[model samples]
Target: MGELIVIRHAQASFGSDDYDRLSDLGHQQAELVGAALRDMGWVPDRLITGTLARQKQTLRGMGFDKAPEEHAGWNEYDFHDLLRVKFGGTIPDPVQHDRKTHFRTLRDVLREWQGGGVEGARETWTQFSARIASARQAATREGAERVLVISSGGAIGQLTASALGAAPEQMIALNLQVKNTAISRFIFTPRAFFLHEFNATPHFAPKERAHLLSYS
Candidate 1:
C-alpha cells in the first residue's frame, strides 16, 4: 500500500495577461501548506509537478529544495486556448475582474472543451484520463511509500470525480471548490485506490486564513 498526496497549485494571477505565475498570496499559501506538511513530519519519497510555472513555483515555495520531476501528463488543459477555439473570436474579455464572471467563463470554457470544442488541444477527455492513469501507474511502480504531486485544480478534480464515479457536471462542481494549495490524499494498494480525503486545508484552519481557501 502507498499514500499519494495531490496538491493544487496556489493562487494564480487572475485577470492578468500572464496567469501562469503565482500571486504573492499564492506564495504564502504554498508556504503555509509546506509548514503544515513539515509539522505532520511528512517527507515524501518522491516529488512531482506538472510542467507549469505555477505548479513548480508552488512546490519550491513550500520549501521543497530539490527539483521535482516534471510530468507532462500532469499539465492542465489550456483554458485560454480552449476559449478561443470554442467561441471563435467571440470570447469576452474577463468582465470587470469579477470573480463570479471569471468562474462562469471558466465553467463555460471547460464545458465546451469537454464537448470537443477545442481544436488541437493536447488530449481529449479519454486521452487525458489515460495519461493520468499512466502517470499513477509509473509513480506506483517506483515503489515509494509516499509520493507528492503538484498540479492544477482541473486535473485533480477530474481524477477525484473519476475515483468517485461522478458525472462530468459533478466534476466541474468539484473543480470549482478545490482550494489553492489544498491537499487531497489517496491510499493505493496493488488492487485498489482509495481516496482518503479531498480538498483539505488544515494549515489555514483559523478564520483569518479563510480567504486563502480559493479554488481559482
Candidate 2:
C-alpha cells in the first residue's frame, strides 16, 4: 500500500501584482506544516508540485533544500481568464467586489465551465480534469510508498473528489473550502486510491497561530 498527501499551497498574495507568490503568512504556514510533519514522524519518499511560484516557494519554506519535481498538469485552472472569456472579455475588477460576490461568481463560473459553457478556454474542463488524473497516475507509479504533492486548491480538490466518485457540485464545494496549507490524505494501492482525509489543518493550533489558517 502507498500513501499520498496532497497539500494546498499556503495563502498567496491575493490582490497583489503577483498573485502567484506566497504571502509572508503563507511562508510561515508552510514552515508550520513542515514542523507538523516532523511531529508526526512522517517523511515523504517523493515530492511533487505545480510550476506555480507559490507551490515552489511553499516547498522551499518547508525546509527542503532541493526542488521538487514540477508538473504543469498540477497547475491551477486560470479562473481570471475564465471570468474574462465568460464575460466576453469584460471582467469586472475583482477588487471592487466583496469576497462573497467573488466566490459566488467563481461558483457559477465553475459550473458553466463544467457544463461546457466556457468558450475560448485554454483547456476544456475535460482536459483540465484529465491533466489532474494524469498527474496522479504518474505520482502513484511504483517505488513510491509515501508521496507529497504541493498544489493549488483546484487541482487538489478535483483529484480528491474524483477519487471518491463525487458529483460535480461536490467537487466544486471541495475546491471552495480548501484552506491554505491544509493536508488531504489518500490511501493508494496498486489498484485503487481512497480518500482518507480532507482539509486538515493540524499545524494551526494553540490559538495564537490560528491567524495562520486561511483559505485564500
Candidate 3:
C-alpha cells in the first residue's frame, strides 16, 4: 500500500480580474502547510499538480521548486465559463463579494453544469471521474510510497467520493468543505484505495495559525 496526499490550492484572488492567481494570504497558507509537512517529516516520493496557475503556484509557495508532473486530468471545471454557458450573456458581474452570494452562485452554476448546461465544456462528470481514476491508477502503479498531488477541490472531491462509493451530491458536499491549501489523505493498495482523511486543515489550526485562514 502507498499513501496519497491531495492538497487543494490556496485561496485565489476571488472576485478579482484574475481568479487563477493566489492571494497574499494564500502564499502564507502554502508556506505554513509546507512547514507543517516538514515538521511531520513527510516528504513525497512523487509530486503531481494540475495545469492551473494556482495549483502550480501553491506547490512553489510550499517550497517544492522543481516542476511537478502536470496532468490535465486534475484540472477543475471553469466556473465562469460554465456560468456563461448556463446564463448565456445575462450573467451578472460578481460585485458584492458576499460569501453567501458567491457560494450560492457557485452552487447553482455547478448544478447547471452537471446537468449538461455548459456548452463547449471539455469533460462531463463521468469523463472527469474516469480520468481522475486513471490518473490515480497510473500514480499507484509507479510504486511510490508517498505521493503528493496539488489539485482543485472538484477533482479531489470526486476522486474521494468515487473511492468511498458516495453519491454525486455527497461529492459536491465534500467539495464545498475543502479549504484552501487543505490536505486530504488516502491509503492505496494494489486492489483498492481508502480515504483516511478529508479536508484536513491541521497546517493552519485555529489556535496556532488563526491569521492564516482566508476564504478568498
Worst 10 residues of 1 by lDDT: 87-96
Q: Which residue pairs clash within candidate 2?
A: none
Best candidate (score: TM-score): 2
Where model 2 places Cα greater than 4 Å from the true spot, the runs are: 95-97
CA lDDT, every prediction? Answer: 0.82, 0.88, 0.80
Colliding residue pairs in candidate 1? none
User: What value does the lDDT take at residue 184 in candidate 1?
Assistant: 93
**Candidate 3 lDDT tens digits, 75-193:** 87666666665666545765225667767887766766666666565566567678888778876775589999999988888889988998776777778888898889999888879
Candidate 2 residue-wise lDDT, 1-216, digit = tens:
999999999888876658899888998999999889879998898999999999999888898554478888889998878887878887677622456777889899999999998989888899999999999988899988989999998998898889999986677899999999999999999899999999999899779888779989
Report per-prediction Cα RMSD to one decimal: 1.9, 1.3, 1.9
Indicate the residue-level lDDT of 171 in model 3.
72
Local lDDT at 133 for model 3: 84
User: TM-score for every candidate vs. truth?
Assistant: 0.91, 0.96, 0.91
